[model samples]
Target: MSAIYDRVALIGLGLIAGSMAHAIREGGLAREVVGYARSAETRETAREINLCDRIVDSAAEAVADADLVVLAVPVGAMAAVAADIAPHLKPGATVTDVGSVKQSVIDAVAPHIPQGIHFVPGHPLAGTEHSGPRAGFASLFRNRWWLLTPLPDTDPAAVDRLTDLVRAMGAKTDRMEPAHHDLVLAVTSHAPHLIAFTMVGVADHLRRVTDEEVVQYSAAGFRDFTRIAASDPTMWRDVFLHNKDATLDILGRFTEELFVLQRAIRMGDGQQLFDYFTRTRAIRRGII
Candidate 1:
Protein backbone atom coordinates (compact mmCIF):
# COMPACT_ATOMS: atom_id res chain seq x y z
CA MET A 1 0.00 0.00 0.00
CA SER A 2 1.25 3.42 -0.93
CA ALA A 3 0.07 6.97 -0.33
CA ILE A 4 -3.14 7.76 -2.22
CA TYR A 5 -3.62 11.25 -0.77
CA ASP A 6 -1.14 13.88 0.43
CA ARG A 7 -3.38 14.67 3.36
CA VAL A 8 -6.66 13.21 4.60
CA ALA A 9 -8.92 14.91 7.12
CA LEU A 10 -11.35 12.91 9.21
CA ILE A 11 -14.18 14.73 10.99
CA GLY A 12 -15.48 12.97 14.14
CA LEU A 13 -13.10 10.58 15.88
CA GLY A 14 -15.52 7.75 16.59
CA LEU A 15 -15.42 4.07 15.71
CA ILE A 16 -15.51 4.43 11.93
CA ALA A 17 -13.08 7.31 11.81
CA GLY A 18 -10.75 5.78 14.35
CA SER A 19 -10.75 2.48 12.51
CA MET A 20 -10.00 4.32 9.28
CA ALA A 21 -7.08 6.06 10.95
CA HIS A 22 -5.64 2.73 12.04
CA ALA A 23 -6.16 1.24 8.59
CA ILE A 24 -4.70 4.24 6.80
CA ARG A 25 -1.65 4.17 9.02
CA GLU A 26 -1.24 0.45 8.69
CA GLY A 27 -1.55 0.59 4.91
CA GLY A 28 0.35 3.87 4.38
CA LEU A 29 -2.60 5.08 2.35
CA ALA A 30 -2.25 8.74 3.33
CA ARG A 31 0.87 10.83 3.85
CA GLU A 32 -0.82 12.75 6.64
CA VAL A 33 -4.00 11.93 8.57
CA VAL A 34 -5.59 14.61 10.74
CA GLY A 35 -8.85 14.42 12.68
CA TYR A 36 -11.32 16.41 14.81
CA ALA A 37 -14.28 15.71 17.07
CA ARG A 38 -16.87 18.02 18.64
CA SER A 39 -16.39 16.56 22.09
CA ALA A 40 -13.39 17.83 24.01
CA GLU A 41 -13.15 14.51 25.82
CA THR A 42 -13.16 12.63 22.55
CA ARG A 43 -10.28 14.80 21.29
CA GLU A 44 -8.35 14.08 24.47
CA THR A 45 -8.94 10.38 24.07
CA ALA A 46 -7.90 10.45 20.43
CA ARG A 47 -4.72 12.26 21.35
CA GLU A 48 -3.99 9.79 24.11
CA ILE A 49 -4.37 6.86 21.74
CA ASN A 50 -2.51 8.57 18.86
CA LEU A 51 -5.54 7.96 16.66
CA CYS A 52 -4.28 10.27 13.95
CA ASP A 53 -1.01 11.97 13.07
CA ARG A 54 -2.54 15.23 14.25
CA ILE A 55 -5.77 15.86 16.22
CA VAL A 56 -7.01 19.36 15.53
CA ASP A 57 -9.32 21.46 17.68
CA SER A 58 -11.79 22.28 14.92
CA ALA A 59 -13.12 20.62 11.76
CA ALA A 60 -12.02 23.64 9.76
CA GLU A 61 -8.43 23.30 10.90
CA ALA A 62 -8.39 19.56 10.38
CA VAL A 63 -9.42 19.93 6.73
CA ALA A 64 -7.04 22.74 5.82
CA ASP A 65 -5.35 21.92 2.52
CA ALA A 66 -6.49 18.32 2.86
CA ASP A 67 -6.72 16.31 -0.36
CA LEU A 68 -9.40 14.02 1.04
CA VAL A 69 -11.96 14.94 3.68
CA VAL A 70 -14.10 12.24 5.26
CA LEU A 71 -17.22 13.23 7.21
CA ALA A 72 -17.41 10.46 9.77
CA VAL A 73 -19.98 12.10 12.02
CA PRO A 74 -23.55 10.99 12.68
CA VAL A 75 -25.91 11.28 9.69
CA GLY A 76 -27.85 14.10 11.39
CA ALA A 77 -24.64 16.11 11.84
CA MET A 78 -23.53 15.88 8.19
CA ALA A 79 -24.99 19.22 7.12
CA ALA A 80 -23.52 21.17 9.99
CA VAL A 81 -20.09 19.60 9.52
CA ALA A 82 -20.28 20.19 5.79
CA ALA A 83 -21.11 23.83 6.32
CA ASP A 84 -18.26 24.32 8.74
CA ILE A 85 -15.68 22.68 6.48
CA ALA A 86 -16.99 23.81 3.10
CA PRO A 87 -15.41 27.24 3.18
CA HIS A 88 -12.08 25.75 4.23
CA LEU A 89 -11.90 23.01 1.60
CA LYS A 90 -9.15 23.09 -1.01
CA PRO A 91 -10.34 23.66 -4.57
CA GLY A 92 -9.61 20.15 -5.87
CA ALA A 93 -10.23 18.30 -2.65
CA THR A 94 -12.66 15.38 -2.52
CA VAL A 95 -15.22 15.14 0.26
CA THR A 96 -16.89 11.88 1.23
CA ASP A 97 -19.06 10.70 4.12
CA VAL A 98 -19.66 7.47 6.03
CA GLY A 99 -23.35 8.07 6.65
CA SER A 100 -25.64 5.03 6.36
CA VAL A 101 -28.60 7.00 4.96
CA LYS A 102 -27.31 8.14 1.59
CA GLN A 103 -30.18 10.24 0.19
CA SER A 104 -30.71 12.37 3.29
CA VAL A 105 -27.00 12.92 3.78
CA ILE A 106 -26.61 14.00 0.16
CA ASP A 107 -29.59 16.31 0.56
CA ALA A 108 -27.99 17.83 3.64
CA VAL A 109 -24.32 18.07 2.57
CA ALA A 110 -24.44 18.53 -1.20
CA PRO A 111 -25.73 22.08 -1.05
CA HIS A 112 -22.78 23.14 1.09
CA ILE A 113 -20.01 21.78 -1.16
CA PRO A 114 -18.12 24.43 -3.06
CA GLN A 115 -17.87 24.42 -6.85
CA GLY A 116 -14.53 22.67 -7.42
CA ILE A 117 -14.74 20.01 -4.74
CA HIS A 118 -16.19 16.53 -5.26
CA PHE A 119 -18.86 15.18 -2.88
CA VAL A 120 -19.20 11.40 -2.85
CA PRO A 121 -21.59 9.78 -0.40
CA GLY A 122 -20.63 6.35 0.94
CA HIS A 123 -21.43 3.69 3.56
CA PRO A 124 -19.14 0.92 4.78
CA LEU A 125 -20.97 -2.31 5.61
CA ALA A 126 -18.73 -3.18 8.54
CA GLY A 127 -18.70 -2.59 12.28
CA THR A 128 -19.12 -4.16 15.68
CA GLU A 129 -21.68 -3.23 18.33
CA HIS A 130 -18.78 -1.43 20.03
CA SER A 131 -18.15 2.28 19.34
CA GLY A 132 -16.07 5.26 20.55
CA PRO A 133 -12.49 6.26 19.72
CA ARG A 134 -10.91 3.33 21.54
CA ALA A 135 -13.06 0.67 19.92
CA GLY A 136 -11.50 0.65 16.46
CA PHE A 137 -8.92 -1.73 14.95
CA ALA A 138 -7.05 -1.76 11.62
CA SER A 139 -8.73 -4.97 10.43
CA LEU A 140 -12.29 -3.75 11.09
CA PHE A 141 -12.91 -3.28 7.37
CA ARG A 142 -10.94 -6.24 6.04
CA ASN A 143 -12.89 -8.01 3.27
CA ARG A 144 -15.95 -5.88 4.13
CA TRP A 145 -18.05 -4.03 1.57
CA TRP A 146 -17.71 -0.28 1.15
CA LEU A 147 -20.52 1.09 -0.98
CA LEU A 148 -20.23 4.47 -2.64
CA THR A 149 -23.26 6.27 -4.06
CA PRO A 150 -21.60 9.00 -6.05
CA LEU A 151 -23.80 11.39 -8.01
CA PRO A 152 -23.90 10.79 -11.73
CA ASP A 153 -22.12 14.07 -12.43
CA THR A 154 -19.31 13.33 -9.95
CA ASP A 155 -15.81 13.21 -11.34
CA PRO A 156 -14.77 9.70 -12.31
CA ALA A 157 -11.12 10.32 -11.40
CA ALA A 158 -12.07 11.40 -7.88
CA VAL A 159 -14.24 8.34 -7.38
CA ASP A 160 -11.51 6.10 -8.67
CA ARG A 161 -8.97 7.60 -6.31
CA LEU A 162 -11.27 6.98 -3.34
CA THR A 163 -11.88 3.44 -4.44
CA ASP A 164 -8.14 2.87 -4.58
CA LEU A 165 -7.68 4.18 -1.06
CA VAL A 166 -10.47 2.04 0.40
CA ARG A 167 -9.26 -1.01 -1.45
CA ALA A 168 -5.75 -0.48 -0.12
CA MET A 169 -7.22 -0.30 3.36
CA GLY A 170 -8.70 -3.82 2.91
CA ALA A 171 -12.27 -3.21 1.72
CA LYS A 172 -14.03 -4.29 -1.46
CA THR A 173 -15.66 -1.26 -3.13
CA ASP A 174 -18.92 -1.10 -5.07
CA ARG A 175 -20.87 1.75 -6.62
CA MET A 176 -24.66 2.15 -6.67
CA GLU A 177 -27.42 4.70 -7.18
CA PRO A 178 -28.24 6.55 -3.98
CA ALA A 179 -31.92 5.64 -3.71
CA HIS A 180 -31.29 2.01 -4.61
CA HIS A 181 -28.52 1.85 -2.03
CA ASP A 182 -30.93 3.12 0.63
CA LEU A 183 -33.52 0.48 -0.20
CA VAL A 184 -30.93 -2.31 -0.21
CA LEU A 185 -29.55 -1.18 3.12
CA ALA A 186 -33.06 -0.99 4.54
CA VAL A 187 -33.63 -4.69 3.89
CA THR A 188 -30.09 -5.80 4.81
CA SER A 189 -29.30 -3.54 7.78
CA HIS A 190 -31.92 -1.09 9.03
CA ALA A 191 -35.01 -3.30 9.34
CA PRO A 192 -32.97 -6.09 10.90
CA HIS A 193 -31.65 -3.66 13.53
CA LEU A 194 -35.15 -2.42 14.25
CA ILE A 195 -36.33 -5.98 14.76
CA ALA A 196 -33.40 -6.64 17.09
CA PHE A 197 -34.21 -3.60 19.21
CA THR A 198 -37.86 -4.59 19.30
CA MET A 199 -37.06 -8.15 20.36
CA VAL A 200 -34.81 -6.93 23.18
CA GLY A 201 -37.50 -4.49 24.30
CA VAL A 202 -40.08 -7.25 24.35
CA ALA A 203 -37.89 -9.28 26.70
CA ASP A 204 -37.71 -6.28 29.02
CA HIS A 205 -41.51 -5.90 28.95
CA LEU A 206 -42.30 -9.53 29.66
CA ARG A 207 -43.37 -9.58 33.32
CA ARG A 208 -43.44 -13.37 33.49
CA VAL A 209 -39.74 -13.53 32.57
CA THR A 210 -37.37 -12.35 35.25
CA ASP A 211 -34.53 -10.13 34.11
CA GLU A 212 -32.00 -12.44 35.74
CA GLU A 213 -33.44 -15.45 33.97
CA VAL A 214 -33.49 -13.68 30.64
CA VAL A 215 -29.84 -12.73 31.05
CA GLN A 216 -28.79 -16.15 32.26
CA TYR A 217 -30.74 -18.19 29.73
CA SER A 218 -30.34 -16.07 26.62
CA ALA A 219 -29.68 -18.46 23.74
CA ALA A 220 -27.41 -17.61 20.78
CA GLY A 221 -30.33 -16.11 18.81
CA PHE A 222 -31.43 -13.73 21.55
CA ARG A 223 -27.81 -12.87 22.35
CA ASP A 224 -27.24 -11.82 18.76
CA PHE A 225 -30.34 -9.63 19.01
CA THR A 226 -28.91 -7.99 22.11
CA ARG A 227 -25.62 -7.34 20.28
CA ILE A 228 -27.43 -5.60 17.42
CA ALA A 229 -29.58 -3.66 19.87
CA ALA A 230 -26.43 -2.47 21.64
CA SER A 231 -25.45 -0.15 18.78
CA ASP A 232 -25.26 3.56 19.55
CA PRO A 233 -28.77 4.94 20.12
CA THR A 234 -28.01 8.40 18.71
CA MET A 235 -26.70 6.96 15.44
CA TRP A 236 -29.58 4.48 15.07
CA ARG A 237 -32.19 7.14 15.85
CA ASP A 238 -30.84 9.45 13.15
CA VAL A 239 -30.59 6.54 10.68
CA PHE A 240 -34.24 5.57 11.23
CA LEU A 241 -35.49 9.16 11.12
CA HIS A 242 -33.60 10.00 7.93
CA ASN A 243 -34.34 6.70 6.17
CA LYS A 244 -37.97 6.40 7.23
CA ASP A 245 -39.61 5.48 3.92
CA ALA A 246 -37.23 2.68 2.88
CA THR A 247 -37.09 1.24 6.38
CA LEU A 248 -40.86 1.35 6.66
CA ASP A 249 -41.25 -0.43 3.36
CA ILE A 250 -38.98 -3.25 4.52
CA LEU A 251 -40.60 -3.39 7.94
CA GLY A 252 -44.04 -3.73 6.36
CA ARG A 253 -42.87 -6.73 4.37
CA PHE A 254 -41.28 -8.17 7.49
CA THR A 255 -44.55 -7.75 9.36
CA GLU A 256 -46.43 -9.70 6.70
CA GLU A 257 -43.88 -12.52 6.95
CA LEU A 258 -44.12 -12.50 10.73
CA PHE A 259 -47.91 -12.75 10.63
CA VAL A 260 -47.71 -15.75 8.35
CA LEU A 261 -45.31 -17.48 10.72
CA GLN A 262 -47.58 -16.69 13.66
CA ARG A 263 -50.61 -18.17 11.88
CA ALA A 264 -48.64 -21.30 10.99
CA ILE A 265 -47.73 -21.79 14.62
CA ARG A 266 -51.29 -21.25 15.81
CA MET A 267 -52.85 -23.60 13.20
CA GLY A 268 -50.15 -26.32 13.47
CA ASP A 269 -49.39 -26.14 9.75
CA GLY A 270 -46.17 -28.16 9.93
CA GLN A 271 -45.62 -28.30 6.20
CA GLN A 272 -45.91 -24.55 5.73
CA LEU A 273 -43.64 -23.93 8.75
CA PHE A 274 -41.04 -26.44 7.56
CA ASP A 275 -41.05 -25.13 4.01
CA TYR A 276 -40.71 -21.52 5.11
CA PHE A 277 -37.86 -22.40 7.45
CA THR A 278 -36.16 -24.43 4.78
CA ARG A 279 -36.27 -21.58 2.27
CA THR A 280 -35.01 -19.07 4.82
CA ARG A 281 -32.30 -21.50 5.88
CA ALA A 282 -31.12 -21.69 2.29
CA ILE A 283 -30.85 -17.91 2.18
CA ARG A 284 -28.63 -17.98 5.28
CA ARG A 285 -26.52 -20.64 3.65
CA GLY A 286 -26.10 -18.44 0.62
CA ILE A 287 -24.91 -15.58 2.80
CA ILE A 288 -22.42 -17.85 4.57
Candidate 2:
Protein backbone atom coordinates (compact mmCIF):
# COMPACT_ATOMS: atom_id res chain seq x y z
CA MET A 1 0.00 0.00 0.00
CA SER A 2 1.27 3.47 -0.92
CA ALA A 3 -0.09 6.97 -0.58
CA ILE A 4 -0.41 8.32 -4.11
CA TYR A 5 -1.67 11.75 -3.08
CA ASP A 6 -1.25 13.64 0.18
CA ARG A 7 -4.89 14.68 0.12
CA VAL A 8 -7.71 13.83 -2.29
CA ALA A 9 -10.79 16.01 -2.61
CA LEU A 10 -14.10 14.47 -3.70
CA ILE A 11 -16.61 16.96 -5.15
CA GLY A 12 -19.77 14.85 -4.79
CA LEU A 13 -20.84 12.40 -2.12
CA GLY A 14 -22.89 9.88 -4.04
CA LEU A 15 -22.26 6.19 -4.76
CA ILE A 16 -19.16 6.79 -6.86
CA ALA A 17 -17.67 9.18 -4.33
CA GLY A 18 -18.39 6.87 -1.43
CA SER A 19 -16.87 3.96 -3.27
CA MET A 20 -13.75 5.98 -3.93
CA ALA A 21 -13.47 6.86 -0.27
CA HIS A 22 -13.77 3.22 0.71
CA ALA A 23 -11.33 2.06 -1.94
CA ILE A 24 -8.72 4.67 -1.09
CA ARG A 25 -8.99 3.96 2.62
CA GLU A 26 -8.72 0.22 2.11
CA GLY A 27 -5.70 0.61 -0.16
CA GLY A 28 -4.11 3.54 1.65
CA LEU A 29 -4.07 5.44 -1.62
CA ALA A 30 -4.52 8.89 -0.08
CA ARG A 31 -3.41 10.48 3.18
CA GLU A 32 -6.80 12.14 3.57
CA VAL A 33 -10.15 12.43 1.76
CA VAL A 34 -12.17 15.64 1.88
CA GLY A 35 -15.68 15.62 0.43
CA TYR A 36 -18.52 18.02 -0.45
CA ALA A 37 -22.08 17.61 -1.62
CA ARG A 38 -24.83 20.04 -2.67
CA SER A 39 -27.38 18.88 -0.12
CA ALA A 40 -26.65 19.29 3.56
CA GLU A 41 -28.46 16.01 4.16
CA THR A 42 -26.09 14.17 1.80
CA ARG A 43 -23.04 15.72 3.43
CA GLU A 44 -24.34 14.71 6.82
CA THR A 45 -25.01 11.20 5.63
CA ALA A 46 -21.53 10.98 4.17
CA ARG A 47 -20.10 12.02 7.55
CA GLU A 48 -22.28 9.46 9.42
CA ILE A 49 -21.06 6.77 7.05
CA ASN A 50 -17.42 7.82 7.69
CA LEU A 51 -16.69 7.90 3.97
CA CYS A 52 -14.13 10.69 4.14
CA ASP A 53 -11.56 12.11 6.53
CA ARG A 54 -13.48 15.37 6.46
CA ILE A 55 -16.80 16.58 5.02
CA VAL A 56 -17.34 20.24 4.18
CA ASP A 57 -20.13 22.63 3.17
CA SER A 58 -18.99 23.71 -0.30
CA ALA A 59 -16.97 22.41 -3.27
CA ALA A 60 -14.47 25.28 -2.97
CA GLU A 61 -13.85 24.45 0.66
CA ALA A 62 -13.16 20.77 -0.09
CA VAL A 63 -10.46 21.16 -2.77
CA ALA A 64 -8.17 23.42 -0.77
CA ASP A 65 -4.60 22.04 -0.67
CA ALA A 66 -5.67 18.67 -2.15
CA ASP A 67 -3.13 16.97 -4.40
CA LEU A 68 -5.86 15.18 -6.38
CA VAL A 69 -9.48 16.21 -6.85
CA VAL A 70 -12.12 13.82 -8.15
CA LEU A 71 -15.36 15.33 -9.41
CA ALA A 72 -17.76 12.48 -8.84
CA VAL A 73 -20.84 14.45 -9.73
CA PRO A 74 -23.29 13.91 -12.61
CA VAL A 75 -22.16 14.60 -16.19
CA GLY A 76 -24.41 17.69 -16.41
CA ALA A 77 -22.79 19.32 -13.36
CA MET A 78 -19.17 19.01 -14.49
CA ALA A 79 -18.71 22.62 -15.53
CA ALA A 80 -20.30 24.06 -12.42
CA VAL A 81 -18.26 21.81 -10.15
CA ALA A 82 -15.11 22.69 -12.04
CA ALA A 83 -15.91 26.39 -11.68
CA ASP A 84 -16.51 26.01 -7.97
CA ILE A 85 -13.21 24.20 -7.38
CA ALA A 86 -10.98 25.97 -9.87
CA PRO A 87 -9.66 28.75 -7.64
CA HIS A 88 -9.26 26.47 -4.64
CA LEU A 89 -7.24 23.73 -6.31
CA LYS A 90 -3.53 23.93 -5.50
CA PRO A 91 -1.20 24.45 -8.44
CA GLY A 92 -0.02 21.15 -10.08
CA ALA A 93 -2.90 19.24 -8.47
CA THR A 94 -4.58 16.65 -10.69
CA VAL A 95 -8.30 16.95 -11.44
CA THR A 96 -10.46 14.15 -12.76
CA ASP A 97 -14.09 13.08 -12.98
CA VAL A 98 -16.15 9.89 -12.73
CA GLY A 99 -18.76 10.70 -15.35
CA SER A 100 -20.51 8.21 -17.62
CA VAL A 101 -20.13 10.29 -20.77
CA LYS A 102 -16.59 11.50 -21.49
CA GLN A 103 -16.79 14.05 -24.35
CA SER A 104 -19.41 16.21 -22.69
CA VAL A 105 -17.55 16.05 -19.39
CA ILE A 106 -14.28 17.06 -21.01
CA ASP A 107 -16.01 19.86 -22.91
CA ALA A 108 -17.66 21.15 -19.75
CA VAL A 109 -14.72 20.93 -17.34
CA ALA A 110 -11.70 21.57 -19.56
CA PRO A 111 -12.26 25.29 -20.03
CA HIS A 112 -12.72 25.85 -16.32
CA ILE A 113 -9.46 24.16 -15.30
CA PRO A 114 -6.67 26.56 -14.45
CA GLN A 115 -3.32 26.52 -16.27
CA GLY A 116 -1.22 24.99 -13.49
CA ILE A 117 -3.60 22.13 -12.78
CA HIS A 118 -3.96 18.84 -14.66
CA PHE A 119 -7.39 17.81 -15.97
CA VAL A 120 -7.65 14.11 -16.75
CA PRO A 121 -11.21 13.25 -17.71
CA GLY A 122 -12.04 9.68 -16.75
CA HIS A 123 -15.00 7.29 -16.56
CA PRO A 124 -15.15 4.09 -14.56
CA LEU A 125 -17.34 1.64 -16.50
CA ALA A 126 -18.83 0.35 -13.28
CA GLY A 127 -21.73 0.92 -10.89
CA THR A 128 -25.01 -0.64 -9.85
CA GLU A 129 -28.56 0.66 -10.28
CA HIS A 130 -28.36 1.96 -6.74
CA SER A 131 -27.69 5.61 -5.78
CA GLY A 132 -26.78 7.62 -2.67
CA PRO A 133 -23.95 7.08 -0.21
CA ARG A 134 -25.52 4.01 1.37
CA ALA A 135 -25.54 2.09 -1.92
CA GLY A 136 -21.77 2.06 -2.35
CA PHE A 137 -19.56 -0.97 -1.69
CA ALA A 138 -15.78 -1.08 -1.43
CA SER A 139 -15.41 -3.76 -4.10
CA LEU A 140 -17.47 -2.09 -6.83
CA PHE A 141 -14.39 -1.25 -8.89
CA ARG A 142 -12.90 -4.72 -8.79
CA ASN A 143 -12.28 -6.00 -12.31
CA ARG A 144 -14.04 -2.98 -13.86
CA TRP A 145 -12.77 -0.91 -16.77
CA TRP A 146 -11.57 2.59 -15.92
CA LEU A 147 -11.32 4.66 -19.08
CA LEU A 148 -9.11 7.75 -19.27
CA THR A 149 -9.51 10.42 -21.93
CA PRO A 150 -6.46 12.60 -21.51
CA LEU A 151 -5.82 15.73 -23.50
CA PRO A 152 -2.96 15.77 -26.00
CA ASP A 153 -0.88 18.12 -23.90
CA THR A 154 -1.58 16.30 -20.62
CA ASP A 155 1.52 15.76 -18.49
CA PRO A 156 2.69 12.16 -18.66
CA ALA A 157 3.51 12.05 -14.97
CA ALA A 158 0.04 13.19 -14.03
CA VAL A 159 -1.54 10.63 -16.36
CA ASP A 160 0.55 7.88 -14.81
CA ARG A 161 -0.36 9.05 -11.32
CA LEU A 162 -4.08 8.87 -12.09
CA THR A 163 -3.67 5.51 -13.79
CA ASP A 164 -1.92 4.18 -10.69
CA LEU A 165 -4.69 5.53 -8.50
CA VAL A 166 -7.32 3.84 -10.66
CA ARG A 167 -5.51 0.53 -10.52
CA ALA A 168 -5.10 0.84 -6.78
CA MET A 169 -8.88 1.11 -6.57
CA GLY A 170 -9.06 -2.37 -8.17
CA ALA A 171 -9.97 -1.29 -11.70
CA LYS A 172 -7.98 -2.00 -14.84
CA THR A 173 -7.33 1.08 -16.97
CA ASP A 174 -7.91 1.81 -20.65
CA ARG A 175 -7.56 4.90 -22.82
CA MET A 176 -9.42 6.40 -25.80
CA GLU A 177 -10.41 9.66 -27.34
CA PRO A 178 -13.31 11.33 -25.54
CA ALA A 179 -15.54 11.25 -28.63
CA HIS A 180 -14.96 7.54 -29.22
CA HIS A 181 -15.57 6.74 -25.57
CA ASP A 182 -18.91 8.55 -25.67
CA LEU A 183 -19.98 6.85 -28.92
CA VAL A 184 -19.08 3.36 -27.68
CA LEU A 185 -20.74 3.86 -24.34
CA ALA A 186 -23.82 5.26 -26.09
CA VAL A 187 -24.32 1.89 -27.80
CA THR A 188 -23.28 -0.36 -24.91
CA SER A 189 -24.57 1.29 -21.75
CA HIS A 190 -26.76 4.30 -22.59
CA ALA A 191 -28.85 2.63 -25.29
CA PRO A 192 -29.42 -0.50 -23.24
CA HIS A 193 -30.44 1.52 -20.22
CA LEU A 194 -32.88 3.53 -22.34
CA ILE A 195 -34.33 0.38 -23.86
CA ALA A 196 -34.68 -1.20 -20.43
CA PHE A 197 -36.44 1.87 -19.08
CA THR A 198 -38.83 1.91 -22.06
CA MET A 199 -39.60 -1.79 -21.81
CA VAL A 200 -40.32 -1.52 -18.10
CA GLY A 201 -42.63 1.42 -18.70
CA VAL A 202 -44.41 -0.47 -21.48
CA ALA A 203 -44.79 -3.55 -19.31
CA ASP A 204 -46.24 -1.54 -16.46
CA HIS A 205 -48.77 0.01 -18.83
CA LEU A 206 -49.68 -3.41 -20.21
CA ARG A 207 -50.03 -4.72 -16.66
CA ARG A 208 -52.42 -1.90 -15.86
CA VAL A 209 -54.62 -2.90 -18.78
CA THR A 210 -54.36 -6.66 -18.09
CA ASP A 211 -54.67 -6.49 -14.29
CA GLU A 212 -51.02 -7.26 -13.28
CA GLU A 213 -50.70 -10.54 -15.17
CA VAL A 214 -47.35 -9.46 -16.67
CA VAL A 215 -45.63 -9.19 -13.28
CA GLN A 216 -47.26 -12.39 -12.07
CA TYR A 217 -45.62 -14.49 -14.79
CA SER A 218 -42.50 -12.50 -15.69
CA ALA A 219 -39.70 -14.62 -17.10
CA ALA A 220 -35.95 -14.01 -16.60
CA GLY A 221 -35.59 -11.78 -19.68
CA PHE A 222 -38.20 -9.22 -18.67
CA ARG A 223 -37.13 -9.44 -15.01
CA ASP A 224 -33.59 -8.38 -15.91
CA PHE A 225 -34.93 -5.36 -17.78
CA THR A 226 -36.92 -4.42 -14.70
CA ARG A 227 -33.78 -4.46 -12.55
CA ILE A 228 -31.96 -2.21 -14.99
CA ALA A 229 -34.98 0.07 -15.28
CA ALA A 230 -35.05 0.37 -11.50
CA SER A 231 -31.86 2.47 -11.60
CA ASP A 232 -31.79 5.95 -10.04
CA PRO A 233 -33.97 8.26 -12.12
CA THR A 234 -31.93 11.38 -11.43
CA MET A 235 -28.67 9.81 -12.59
CA TRP A 236 -30.19 8.32 -15.74
CA ARG A 237 -31.99 11.56 -16.51
CA ASP A 238 -28.72 13.49 -16.28
CA VAL A 239 -26.96 10.91 -18.46
CA PHE A 240 -29.53 11.12 -21.22
CA LEU A 241 -29.82 14.90 -21.14
CA HIS A 242 -26.06 15.42 -21.33
CA ASN A 243 -25.31 12.70 -23.90
CA LYS A 244 -28.19 13.48 -26.22
CA ASP A 245 -26.49 13.33 -29.59
CA ALA A 246 -24.78 9.96 -29.23
CA THR A 247 -27.84 8.40 -27.61
CA LEU A 248 -30.15 9.60 -30.38
CA ASP A 249 -27.76 8.36 -33.06
CA ILE A 250 -27.69 4.88 -31.57
CA LEU A 251 -31.44 4.93 -30.97
CA GLY A 252 -32.02 5.73 -34.63
CA ARG A 253 -29.97 2.73 -35.69
CA PHE A 254 -31.71 0.51 -33.16
CA THR A 255 -35.13 1.58 -34.46
CA GLU A 256 -34.15 0.87 -38.04
CA GLU A 257 -32.97 -2.64 -37.16
CA LEU A 258 -36.08 -3.24 -35.06
CA PHE A 259 -38.31 -2.29 -37.99
CA VAL A 260 -36.56 -4.78 -40.23
CA LEU A 261 -37.15 -7.57 -37.67
CA GLN A 262 -40.79 -6.49 -37.31
CA ARG A 263 -41.29 -6.75 -41.09
CA ALA A 264 -39.80 -10.26 -41.14
CA ILE A 265 -42.09 -11.38 -38.33
CA ARG A 266 -45.13 -9.85 -40.00
CA MET A 267 -44.36 -11.53 -43.36
CA GLY A 268 -43.83 -14.96 -41.68
CA ASP A 269 -40.35 -14.97 -43.18
CA GLY A 270 -39.00 -17.97 -41.28
CA GLN A 271 -35.56 -18.12 -42.90
CA GLN A 272 -34.80 -14.45 -42.22
CA LEU A 273 -35.88 -14.82 -38.62
CA PHE A 274 -33.75 -17.98 -38.18
CA ASP A 275 -30.69 -16.25 -39.64
CA TYR A 276 -31.17 -13.27 -37.35
CA PHE A 277 -31.46 -15.49 -34.29
CA THR A 278 -28.37 -17.42 -35.24
CA ARG A 279 -26.36 -14.28 -35.77
CA THR A 280 -27.42 -12.80 -32.46
CA ARG A 281 -26.69 -16.07 -30.68
CA ALA A 282 -23.18 -16.06 -32.10
CA ILE A 283 -22.71 -12.51 -30.88
CA ARG A 284 -23.85 -13.50 -27.41
CA ARG A 285 -21.39 -16.37 -27.24
CA GLY A 286 -18.66 -14.09 -28.49
CA ILE A 287 -19.27 -11.87 -25.49
CA ILE A 288 -18.69 -14.82 -23.19
Write model 2 residue lDDT over 192-228, tens digit each, in one string. 9999999888877773456367666788988889889
| TM-scores for candidates 1 onward, in order | 0.98, 0.97
Off by over 4 Å in 2: 207-212
Q: Highest lDDT: which candidate? A: 1
> By summed lDDT, which 10 consecutive residues of candidate 1 come out lowest?
127-136
| Backbone steric clashes in candidate 1, count | 0
RMSD of 2: 1.3
Off by over 4 Å in 1: none
Model 2 poorest ten-residue lDDT run = 207-216
Clashes of 2: 0
TM-score of decoy 2? 0.97
**Model 1 per-residue lDDT at 91:** 97
Candidate 1 per-residue C-alpha lDDT over 1-288 given as tens digits, one digit per residue, 9 for 90 to 100: 669999999999889999999999988999999999999999999999999999999999999999999999999999999999999999999999999999999999999999999998899999989889998899998999999999989999999999998888889999999999999999999999999999999999999999899889999999999999999998999999999999999999999999999999999999999999999999999999
